[model samples]
Target: MAPATVRRDPGTVKPRIRPSPAPPARVRCATKRAAVRIAYVFDHRLPSTGADTEQLVHMVAALGEAGADVELVLPRIPGRQVPSPDDLAAYYGVPPSFRVRALPGPFPTVRALEKPGFAAVGALARAVRTADLVYTRNLPTAVAVRLAGGPPVLFETYRPWPDQYPASRWLFRGLLRARGSFRMVLHSHYAMERFLRAGLPADRMLVAHNGWDPRKFEPRLSKHEARTRLGLPMDRPLVVYTGRITPKKGLLGVLDMARRLPHVTFLLVGSEGEGSVEREARSMPNVRVEGWTDLASLPPYLYAADVLLIPPTAAPLSKVGNTVLPIKTFPYMASGRAIFGPRSPDLAEILRHGDNAFLVEPDDWDAATAGLRSLLEDPETAERLGRRARADAEGGTWQARAQRVLDFAAPMIRTA
Candidate 1:
């Protein structure tokens, strides 16, 4: 069943669609280089509530804001209403800066159809000469475009397909050796190192970490104001985790920590669907497991937290590489609250121990409990960590991150 609609924030204005063939690309005149015309090709249905979908919308919006003539080439499912620019902008809390070009493809309702639409829309995107470079997460699509005598490809991914995905690693390596200035973007150095070891030249791959849209987090509501809005308690100390309520994300650790520390109220604000994890997490006496809060309504819950908790488990997903870093880290940092999180290499890239955040051994439930308690007990320390974190977050804005990506890919885009 569809969730009830969230009332739009009154202060927010609808994105203006300038009368043109599409919205006129905003170009910063001071930039010496020409605006890079980018066709960001995607394989999924739009306006969905996935983290990757959010990342895509925010990334393209920032790319557009950074003075790129960007267009999104996506699949067209016959019966579905294509998500309009306003819908994308409004849903993601971003500016309507890029255009969407949807080409006819098979609807991915069945297992066999999931991979078909991507290559079709991608090939069509390249065939039309709509962009000087086709940027995609689809590695195979990148190869297809290059082999079809199309323009340059800037492939982006969180997975290190070049090294680990046994089937494609060999093919990708071959592409690297036979290529004409091939380029790729990875989300973290952890992923980048894999590509480097796999014979992708150091200069060919970039680590463009995922970022947050500041509008969703900025002009932050105060703790008191936010608590009142969310109907949370004022008398008790509250710690919050505002993402998926899965064991892979370390929710089981959160449950154990909650049981050990009954004095502190634990709130889990983003569970979707029912499962043993969800049932067990909700059944905890002191924990409040709210189901699937919409994007627009989630910030106040963060603002209301005394401490932002991202529990650390010994090993998530057991063997396969985990989603090492959580996207919530950005907003959690942006919230200006002391974050209590895991000590992992991926998070180590951005979060510092004893600097902006207090980190404890992942899977060390006792240590996490002790650390969280210590943070909550000391208000001065908490405030200092939060201030430093917020200051650091200013540098990690999506606008800033996007500019860096453009700068990294600038030379490649130019020659293409």
Candidate 2:
């Protein structure tokens, strides 16, 4: 059945739709039947697998593992460079049960609405209508999912875009309410709290933590072997900051840390987006900038590193980038390396001082360097911390993560 026409609230930035109250946990399973149809709407465009895509891939893979028939709705971007045939195969070959469909788009944005992105709304709505449930991983797609008629829509909002645009907050909130009687999923407790403050019903929101793909990041070769492969010096301690070279990622702080510890080799393994901090780290002999790596090659980099540096930039929007810990943390932990992080509210959940990770003030080179030096100088303490980190990561694999999503969505999945 198509959703009833939702009434617009004059005050809200977005249109409004009210979802039905979710049934109790016990009733969800008994009443619901058939294999759950889980639709993942997201972007799989190249340049790199952004955090949203990475999270989607793992979630889709896990949903399939949980016996849910999953279909991945990818944006069919034109003019964008597609991956090589081998890479394309690897990227799309998530899990057997998961399928991919591209929504053609080059949507021009007018005000807040993406016109081309809206092209996806019709097709996705049709697809969601057939499925047991509609699941959207990114914000742009969430708009389409909300507009579409479906069994039930459950959106995983990464951040509060409506909050960013106060002008459209009401409109977005209305649209959120109009999500065809669906649930909204969040990645962190921080995210959940944000939605609650925005007037989203607490029961309608859920926190699905990040999960890692164990295959891509397992305990590969030892530090010596891995370093040898990367051509990094085996003698000096190596601290790595992996991910895209963006401002919020705190690549500048990485340079500061490298300067503080000349004896420590700072290895950055990832591509640099426009306006990168590469220039600063380029000339330093102790630093190596390895641009763009395939997923297969990442294990060696993680294994070779003595510590993982997660220095997110100090900014209000930094929460968008740093709050939910990256999937890389899974492999970093599995590799049994000491991990360091910038003190941020979002990261507070994943990291604990002197436990799983060493948290320090963002851009505080003195404290960051001190933490790095402690890990480098005290091998016993480093090993103990690494052991704990690895244990924590191994427990948070895609399998476990998928299960969490299934359990959370059980209420809607059964009904859908």
Candidate 3:
């Protein structure tokens, strides 16, 4: 190759454009004098759903904010590729200390569960060696914790496994293996009570509640504003029901409530798998089905709502729903909307028939309808109730939640 001599004109005023240096790589670091490391195992993989991803993001941020180095490991579907570099970069957008790692599963169902072999054991052991605590999500990660035995484990269970999946019994046995070594974190008093009856030691149990963002779901928005944002009738009251469109969520009861209260429009937000409530609610005219909403987009819908309905069905499908309180409770209350549900002990602490919330007996249309009518007819009472609900929700943030976990694991945290 022949080199050509380049000539520069002395009089030429070249554009003074400086190439933008590659954007500096962003890094999140732990702030504690001695960073506490936590391994958080959850159900989120790439392209995750709304609530699962939101909970994962919140926990990661909370742990990082509390000066802990938090790393998340979620199971990946079999044959699915790991997240791309750009995806990995986006995942790391969380606090610097929050790292997202994906483990492979052979089959789509329980492949993320293949962590007990020697190779898998060694990898987990190495990770656990540096970790002060292990926080596991559902049953799958609970199994992984039993295999990796370095740190004190804290299992965050939303539902009892055996009830949801018959196979869960085998998986739950793993908990017994880690019984003395691990602690269970219950989301509601209902869960605490149920697990206590199941024989888990009281000393091994702790409760951490969930919360919401006021800017997203609050009374700050007028009916007209919320309606405009959500594309609903500005004059009509909006009642919202969110969560998996399944029987346990009490969608049928919500539909019945909608039927009784023809004056209000129902907003059903959630998705279904093979057979779902969304499929069943298709015949309703007053009900609007929004399959699923991202965490960032939930506020408008919440603001547009006049009330948050939680008519849970009396189904024994899983211990998860029956025992654990739904995170929706905090958001529903935080939205400054009246909350109507059965007198569940898990949620009883927050509801007062005519105070912060309205307690309706399960499938009690007469009672639920009566409560709805009172709130709709009297705006003053509704506003008062809504305000009280919002005030009560302030105590349910993830920070408050993480503090409880730390308090329960104080012995291990101090050692770490």
Q: Pick the lDDT winner.
A: 1
Give candidate 3's root-mean-square deviation (CA, Å).
Answer: 12.5
Q: How would the candidate models be sorted by TM-score, starting from the highest? A: 1, 2, 3
TM per candidate comes to 0.87, 0.81, 0.77
Identify the runs in model 2 with alpha carbons over 4 angstroms from their true place: 1-33, 43-47, 78-89, 105-116, 123-125, 160-163, 166-180, 272-276, 316-324, 414-416
Per residue, candidate 2 scores C-alpha lDDT tens digits across 1-416 of: 11111212212222111221221232223535656776676554532456566566657756766677777665555665434423332552344346666555556324244443543553355565677777775555555555554456677766654455555456546755643456777777776676667676677677777766666554458889888877777888888877776656667777777778888888777653324466666567787766655454577888888888777445534544443555566667777788887777777777777898777887677877787788789888777888888888766877787777777777656343
Off by over 4 Å in 3: 1-33, 43-46, 50-53, 76-97, 106-125, 139-148, 160-180, 214-220, 272-276, 316-323, 414-416
Q: In lDDT terms, how accurate is model 2?
A: 0.63
Model 3 — which ten-residue stretch has the worst lDDT? 1-10
Could you tell me the lDDT of residue 322 within candidate 1?
A: 50
- What tens-digit string does per-residue lDDT give for candidate 3 at 1-416? 11111112212322222222232232222333456677776555654554556665666666665556677765665677765423432332323336766665444465344543322442365565567677776554555555655566777766644444456545444565555567777666666665555555677777667655443443367667878876677777778777766666667677777778777788876653434555555666677776555554566676777777777444422333443566677777777877767776666766887889777665667777887777777778777888898888886776567656766765545233
- Lowest-scoring 10 consecutive residues by lDDT in candidate 1? 1-10
Relative to the true structure, how large is the alpha-carbon lDDT of every model? 0.73, 0.63, 0.61
- TM-score winner among the candidates? 1
Model 1 residue 233 lDDT score: 77
Model 1 residue pairs with clashes:
312-363, 314-363
